[model samples]
Target: MKQVLTIAGSDSGGGAGIQADIKTFQELDVFGTSVITAVTAQNTRGVIDVAPVPIENIEKQLQAVGDDFDIAAVKTGMLFDAVTIRTVADSIKHYNWQRLVVDPVMIAKGGASLLKEEAKDSLIKHLLPLATLVTPNIPEAEALSGIQIYNEQTRRMAAEQILKSGAQGVLIKGGHGADPDFTEDFYLDQHGGSLVLRSSRIQTKHTHGTGCTFSAALAAEFAKGKSIEEAFLTAKQFIQSAIEHSLNIGAGHGPTNHSAYRHYAQKEMIRYVH
Candidate 1:
């Protein structure tokens, strides 16, 4: 089995962050390991508190994982501050781990900020250059690129701006868009390849971990040696299925069903054969 690593915060609700990443990795048939950057006191409703792990401890965790596990791919989420982001970036360089998926986790479902405002520069300057793919939702894309995305033209512009930050590819997720009929994600790569991936919008509030899950699925596919285009398609399919069968476990924004993708795939396979 391919081993994948997630360097992220821990969500007490088990709906997002490392919990969701690990669950997605497992559902995708990859071995999941984690280095928790912080611990959040959050439920489905909102984040109550956050305690960032010490920088030294974070370094030690990365060292331990880098020293032992043959991590095939890595996805990072919720590196709270500039220091944490720098540490993770340095570790990624030290290990020379390539197949990296950077999920620019900026905000929570209930309007809580996940990434520090001051650390945005650190993320773009340090971590993004090491990313094989950078996945950002609409709001995050706007924040990163300094371009407001209102339509397809603006969306493409924002993606292009983000691509300039050194990531090989940029996937701007449309989950946060105003589209009521279809969600259209824009993808742009350094090789001049661009695609508009569209999916029917699932009208549900259980999308707490959609970004994390999508990026994690992408990392798992990359670990399995899938091309960026193939991995991008699979990740989109995985998130769509997960959202279509979303779970209503919390009072506020719940989580997408992590196992729904496999079940959906099985049913599709059976249908295709018959």
Candidate 2:
């Protein structure tokens, strides 16, 4: 069985962060492992508190994983400060791991930030260049590029800037800025080619952990030996299905049902097949 690692913060709510990454890995048939950088008290409403795990402990956890498994791929979620980001980046560099997926987890669904302003520079300057793919939502793309991405044109520009910053690839997600009727995601390859993926907007509040889930699935598919384009396509489909079947439970924004697509969508299949 292939193994995938997620270096991130733990979400106490069990809906996003490390918890969501694990669920995504499991759903995609990959063994999930983690090195936690912080712990957050969070729920649908918002994050109540966040405690950055000591940098030394974070480093030790990462090292422990490296020693045990020939880690297939790695996807990172939240590194709260400069110290943790620097530490994780160096550890990843030390291992020279393959297929690194960096989810620029800047803020939570409810606008609670999971990363420090100071750490942002280090993440872009150090970690991103080493990644096989960098996944960022609109705001995250803007933060990294230092430009406000207000529409499709600016979104492309942001993706280009991030790519120029040394990342091998970039996925500028459109969940935050898409038209109410459509959702689009962009991917830029190392060879200077790019692809755009669009989905019909699902009206719901269960959008938590979407960034973590998408990036993790992307890494999982790559770990299982799929091509970057093939992996990106499969991961995008999985995430869209997950979002469409989200549970309408939480008061604010709920979580997607991770097991949603296990069984086929018979009705839709029939509708399309016929």
Candidate 3:
């Protein structure tokens, strides 16, 4: 089986961050490894408090896995702060691991701050250039590019800027924009080309952890040897189906059904062999 590593915070809520990332990897039939940067006391309601794991522990976790396994791809979520970002960045550079995907998770679904204001520069300088693909939603795109992406044109512009900032590819998720049809996800390639993917927008309150799940699935798909664009589309469909089947369990934003892929894989095989 393929192996993928997700370096991010832990959500006790099991919706976003490492929890969701592991589920994505498993759905794609990849072995998942993780290095926790922060731990959150979160549930269905909201994230209550976050305690960042020590920088040394974070480094050890990365070293432990990276030393033993051929990590096909790596994805990051919330780094928590500057020191933690630096720690993770150093490990990645030291290992020179390829196929990196950076999901710029800035805030939580319940309006809690997941990343520190002071860590933004470090992430850009140290971590982003190493990414094969950087996935950031609309608000995160605005924060990263300092440009207001109000429409498709601006979203394209933002994608260009993000790509130039260091990553080989940029996927600007349009979930934040009030687009009528669906969230128009933009993909800007290294050769200055672009692809926009549109899906049926599932209107539901349980939209939490969607970004993390999307990016993680993309990484998992890439680890399975799919092209960057293919990975993005695979992840898009995964998120869409997950959202469609998400249970109304929580009071606030609930979790996606990451396990939906099991149903899909079984059903697809049955149809193919019939």
Instruction: Write the residue-wise lDDT of candidate 2 on 1-274 in tens digits.
Output: 8999999999887888899899989988999999999999988899999999988799889999999988899999998998888888898989888899999898888778788888898998889988999999888999999889887678777888898878899988889874998777887776768787777788888888788888988999999999877787777787788888877868988877777757546112101100
Summarize candidate 3's per-residue lDDT along 1-274 as a digit string, tens digits: 9889999999998999999999989888999999999999998789899999988788889889989988889999999898988888888888887889999989887788888888888888888888999999998999898889887788888888887768898988878779666667888877877777777677888988999999999999888889866787788878878888877878888999998866754211111100
In model 2, what are the clashing residue pairs, if there are any? none
Candidate number that wins on lDDT, 1 or 3: 1
Distance from true location, Cα of 2 in model 3, Å: 0.9
**TM-score of model number 1:** 0.95
The TM-score leader among the candidates is 1
lDDT of 1 by residue, 1-274 (tens): 9999999999999989999999999999999999999999999899999999999999999999999999999999999999999999999999998899999988988888889999999999999999999999999999999999998889888988998999999988888789798787778898778877777888888888889999999999999999877787888888889888877899988988999987876212111100
In order of appearance, the predictions have TM-scores of 0.95, 0.94, 0.94
Best of the two (1, 2) by lDDT: 1
**In model 3, which range of ten residues has the least summed lDDT?**
265-274
Error of 3 at 118 (Å): 1.3
